[model samples]
Target: MEKHSNVKSRRKHISPVFHLQTKKEEDQHITKEVIKSVRRTGQLNLSSRHIATVPEKLFSIYDAEDENTVDWDFGKPKKEEDAWWNINPLSHLDLSSNVLSEIPAQIGMFQDLLVLNVIFGIII
Candidate 1:
């Protein structure tokens, strides 16, 4: 009675890859990455995702005083000539095709918001 070694090896190889992380862990990782990028660029495009509500991070990011969020101080004194803070603040945001019931009041915090697009979505 000889067992097939190849069949057993296949299961061992595939199980580890799929069982590496849970769904919650993956979602947290993605959220963290998005926050990091938004802090640096001050711009975000979350369109056509069928999101029911806006991410809370978008509202708090503008006023976040901690080290995690970006404090966009564009006109402050800088020793470096090409510092990122010296650049212009966030000026645009696109939240289209999402099932948003109403625009959040926190949007007003974005003083640099010049253009906003919310088409084909429920807005109250």
Candidate 2:
């Protein structure tokens, strides 16, 4: 009877429902970090990260700045101490080896994007 009670208590404390919720929370946290980092650095390397869906933030990072777009000169000579703020617009995006089933239509926002690596992602 004591063993059965202990098992019942453990079951209550370690339910599969709790585990599923925790997993969803963790995935959201990771996705937030990825979006924040990519927005700040203008680069995202999510290769082999098991990402299933392309987040919306990745597609709309430039929408708010449409009217205030800065003209970054990618052809100008750069000094050794030049700040990274002069870097060109996000030109390369690597989404290789992820689980992405489709490239969203919002991808058209990246007009200046030069390279988009979606190698080995989901065929659908």
Candidate 3:
């Protein structure tokens, strides 16, 4: 009987640990490609990702270039389409069905944001 109780207790503890590890891995899987796509399309859908907090990288997607890299093409004129001003600003964000507890104040930085979907979620 003591061994049975011990086994149950261990199983319960292991279950939460495993769940936490899986959540951590899923959170880390939010890759640079996703961010780049969002930057280009001005839309981000992170629904049902089990994310408790918004990733910090999303906040700086517009200025992701390294400051140390110097553009040596001073002689060449910049193209209109390739200009930084041409990039699409973040206008839509879908964070529904996530485990988010509070919307970060940084979200307000997206001045061009037109659609923010937080349905089926709770925000404090």
Candidate 4:
């Protein structure tokens, strides 16, 4: 009985450790470069980014200004195929291996999304 009590007391002092991030830290995982790639490829792999919440920009990346819009060369004529409107729409989103608690309602905006891999993550 004394041994059981001592074991229980020892376990009480041992608390599980968790890695918490600030709002800025969590948002840092999603950058302009990442958005650009996703827009071009139509696939976003945000796995293992430790993000608790999905960034709003991820949902509306098609409307967001990108390098092509801002850094256009006026000296040369632009190609029609390279236009921002020609970019591929986001279709595949991989949010696996993350710490997401709940998927945002904005995710529904991804009408073109074909694959949303949320495996190995906590969504509750």
Which candidate leads the pack in lDDT?
4
Q: What Cα-based lDDT does every candidate model obtain?
A: 0.60, 0.62, 0.73, 0.78
Between candidates 3 and 4, which one is better according to TM-score? 4
Candidate 1 has an lDDT of: 0.60
For model 3, give the 10-residue run with minimal summed lDDT: 15-24
Candidate 1 local lDDT, 3-68, one digit each (tens): 677778777877432232333432333365565566566667776655556666566544434678
RMSD in order of candidates: 10.8, 8.6, 5.8, 4.4
Order of candidate numbers by lDDT, starting with the best = 4, 3, 2, 1
- The pairs that clash in candidate 1 are none
Candidate 3 clash total? 0
Clashes of 4: 0
Q: List, residue by residue over 16-84, the lDDT tens digit for candidate 2.
A: 422222334325534555554555656767666566666555665544434776657776535532335
Tens digit of lDDT per residue, candidate 4, span 1-124?
A: 9999999999989974557556677767668788767767899888887777776557556774655657547554376544666688889999998788889888988888999999999888
Q: What is the clash count of model 2? A: 0
Clashing pairs in 3: none
Give candidate 2's whole-model lDDT: 0.62
Q: What is the TM-score of candidate 3?
A: 0.68
Candidate 2 — worst ten consecutive residues by lDDT sum? Answer: 17-26
